[model samples]
Target: MSHTQTIPTRSSINPADTWDLTPLYRDLDAFEAEFSDAESQVNDLSSYRGKISLSPETLLSYLKAKDKQFLIIDRLYSYAFQTSDEDTANTQTQAMKNKTLSLYNRFFASIAWESPEILTLTPEILSDWYTKEPELTNYRHYLEDTLRQKAHTLSPREEEILSLSADMSYGPQTVFNMFNNADLRFPSIDDGNGNTVEVTHGRFISLMENPNRQVRKDAFEALYHTYDSYKNTLAAMYSSNVKKELFYTKARSYTSTMEAHLDCSNIPTKVYAQLIDTVHAFLPSMYRYVALRKKLLGVDELHMYDVYTPIIRYDSPYIPFDTAKEMVLEGLAPLGEDYLSLLKEGFDNRWIDIYENKGKRSGAYSTCVYGHHPYVLLNYQGNLDNVFTLAHEMGHSLHSCYTNRHQTYINSNYNIFVAEIASTCNEYILISHLLKKAETREEKAYLLNHLMDQFKGTLFRQTMFAEFEKITHEKEAKGEPLTCDTLCSIYSDLNKTYFGPDMIIDEEISMEWARIPHFYTPFYVYQYATGLSAAIAFGSRILSGEPSALDDYKKFLSGGCSMDCMDLLKSCGVDMTTSGPTSEALKVFDRYLTELESLF
Candidate 1:
């Protein structure tokens, strides 16, 4: 007997496999009604703009009303985006998402006088108001954060002008997005089997992973050379982005772009520097891993294109969705009974949209509304990677679940700096469980390879990108031109440093920086490195049955933005402000590399 599988339409999908969004809204009519009411409430916030500092009661009332309005808006936005993601081709949902976004924009614009007006009053006055109106105590932290920006806060008119420039400031990123996604093109490459395959942004990584060296080389060269053809134009776009960062940095009275970006989350500059220094200390381990790749491939010279190809080949059995769930549950048992119970609840309830369907989004994500259980969207294919992805995204959902249950709406959202920790920590725990259960050498080796790759890609690779950003921005700040040559040279040198002496730094890799979308976002890539490091540190302690490790980690998960991200991490005993967590993470990488080397 033979069977064929097909992607189902949204309406045709099994109800069990789809998320129960009725928890958010029962029908379109209900959503529309709530949305209309929320819009009215949001618009009414403008009346409280200048009256924010009127009196204690008025201030408290405005704050409460604002939070109430936003909570409704959050639910409406969540429902619209989740629905749109279910079937991107559906015009109705798309329109709904756009409408919600417009209202969201208006909501922020309506409250534009919030910070400046709040800053007009001194901290002592607010503290007095807090005592006078006990209810104002609830927003103590929120008010403190606003006051923290008093030094950087401009006059209302100046602030309004800056806000007006928001759309104009996004010009560089918009141009790059259009050019990279729409206009940029690459030539077709011959597949190892004499088939021609077009190199696309989506397909480039898969091509680089092709077992045939010639195919990998072809894809790498084709993609980079096409980028190289427009190197000057790309350089200008990146330079413009850097200039914009500088403009805002100076405008906000921040000493540098990194300072301005990190200030938002109260992160110290030392944390960024510490990550680079710690990663540099462990470059030898990365070189050893690179050497192992070269030995496993039995190639005299390993090129940049060769780095992504798997050193070991194993064809594991197809994983059914049920099996994936079982695997995740078994793998995450180290997190204890309460965690497992919640995981099972999410599974039993329709909290997850579990499979691919026609017109659905291609990747995976976890989103939450304040009062509802978090929802995870997965385009689950029956594979080991998909299983890991399931574990990863559930980590995010459960994190939000814990936070929403514990924190108020105002503090429920965590910063992006610590966002990936839960997800990556879940990944580490799952991989550890799988490693313990593997009965065959090849299986163990394969699992070990996957674990090592996470270290390489997340910790090492992202830190390198972070360092590149640091150097380029510093040069631009010093009035040095970031021409195509200068950018390529800096990138090429960093690649050689990170990949070590075993790997050949191909000329094509020099143009690699032009293709990175993250660089346009300033100093954001460092968090991927720091998040993984913190996750590994926490994972180690929890798995070893360290006392209070599990409880402390749960506290961190429930923290949300209730505290500074660094303080929250520190309370969990993984202080990212120092190099200890990153160093320990590197040590684990070294241990794994040793074990994998011994297996070979």
Candidate 2:
């Protein structure tokens, strides 16, 4: 743990201090009224079920009605999920999540018309309909993409039944969420002064940065040991999610489950393979960075536990939430005036719940739904990382903000392929701004080390997670079961390869998957790596003080799902279809390694 880490000063700034949801509804009563009206509206969906294809006009109207219903559901569910994540055991909030989810399931199951019904349309008929209907004209791309997946779609009835089972379908994610928040208890850790500090998901990373070696080791063991106790149960839940993926892929008759998943987001499988290949080729840079860190800390050797130690012992500058807001806006000035204004609106209007409060959720993220101001959830400590994190999440929030303003409901939601660009770009901007502001060599070195850590975690570590996902899916494809023992062995081997020969690779590290929430979503974590790679490419362009780069990056933020993910990146001037971004971004990593080693 970084020893300079401290508890957030504004930990008592509860949810009521921010979030003026009055624009969405007057109060909880108003929200309930809207919720009731929506449930009643969706109940009428079955009336037009058989008649959707009577004419193009009729089909277009049905689609609009369906989208309208989804709009209401989106608002309701977004509020519920955000509030629930804040405090998992809050009975009222939990009830809202359940209620909203059930309503979502019902509406989706009742009106699963768009995909299967459109798949039956002849190209000529669809083209004629698009020309005849104004609504259908805007939906041309959306409909075309759905039709392309006709070969993988289930029959309408089966699809509807499955849509109805979404609550059950999300079993693994639900279990993992419960375990993460409510069930798991961590052992206590001793800080630098030997006082017992409790281990928490939020504090674990903080403790990992301790100057004292024993504290880092104790915190690491305490956290993972708790996870290890439940590894088998977590493994079974994880394996079930993987099995669910396999079952869906087989049912759809797709070539592989990966193809089945990518179809949903309109991305190509080549993008995934390209990321894996590029990162694998660049592994030595990451290894070299680790070796440099080992030398800087003056340790006899660096173990897995030693990776987080701070190279500079000076106190980090404290950045409160408001100051951080200004810094974020200043840092992201390259994204153009319109984007900066929207992010500023969030800060002024308290769209951010920026500091941790009692019972508030751990970690940080940007959560958005169409037609509402995007919300950021953070347990903000006044640290440099928290400053950068604010910038990162606001990237995602404004991406949604712009898309909602520009596109129709269906097109506003972007795929994961380009999602990380905004967030990672903000990170680069924050670091660049700070590097410019540094007053000493040690400060610059500390900032550089932190940036290096992000590069390693976001690019290298995520790629490792991605590889683990690929192996598990491939193993399942071969009709093999993924037991706890098998997963442990695979994870341990990966630690050896990625951490390299000099770094101590512990065997119990195999239980790492037990702590990763991303594993529940099969093949989903690779986007972190690809996103950072793309961010580095695009961020480098804009930060170089290039006017065209600023213009291109803003155009990309406004894109949402207006273009395909790969094409969207091409618009921003990076090609996800190739390994160029990953390789080029790794070269930046190599430069940091060189700088870090120079300090040695």
Which candidate leads the pack in lDDT? 1
Name the 10 consecutive residues with the lowest summed lDDT in model 2. Answer: 2-11
Q: Where does candidate 2 clash, by residue pair? A: 1-207, 1-208, 1-209, 1-210, 2-209, 2-210
Tens digits of lDDT, candidate 2, 1-600: 334333333334554545656666677788789889988887687778677667898888877887888888888888877777767757787788789888888888887765787777777898898878866877777777777788877887888877877778788888788778756778776686846677877777767777888998988888778878888888898888888888878878988888888878878888888888888788888778777777777777777888777777858767767788788888777677887889888888878776554455678888787877888887776777778888888888888887788788878888887788888888987887777888988888998899998988899899899989989888988989999999998898998888786788765578888888878887788898989988999889888877688778777877777668888788678887888888999999888768767765
lDDT of 1: 0.87
Report the lDDT of model 2 for residue 443: 86
- Cα lDDT for residue 283, candidate 1: 97
TM-score of each candidate?
A: 0.88, 0.95
lDDT of each: 0.87, 0.80
For each predicted model, how many residue pairs clash, with residues at least 3 apart or on different chains? 0, 6
Writing each residue's lDDT as its tens digit, candidate 1 over 1-600 gives 323334478899899999999999999999999998887776687777788888989888898998888888888989998998787767798689878877776677667778899998888999899889998887888888999989998887777677657756868976785577546768988878766767765456667767799999999999999999999999999999999999999888889899899999888899899899999999999999999999999999999999877788776777999999999999999998989998999999988898877667656789988888999998876777678889989999999988988888888898889988999999999999999998999889989988888898899999999999999988988999999999999999999999999999999999999988888899999998999999998999999999999999999999999888988888889888888889989999999999999998
Best by TM-score: 2
Which portions of model 2 miss their true places by more than 4 Å? 1-17
Candidate 2 lDDT for residue 59: 81
> lDDT at 247 for candidate 2?
81
Question: What is the alpha-carbon lDDT of model 2 when measured against the actual structure?
Answer: 0.80
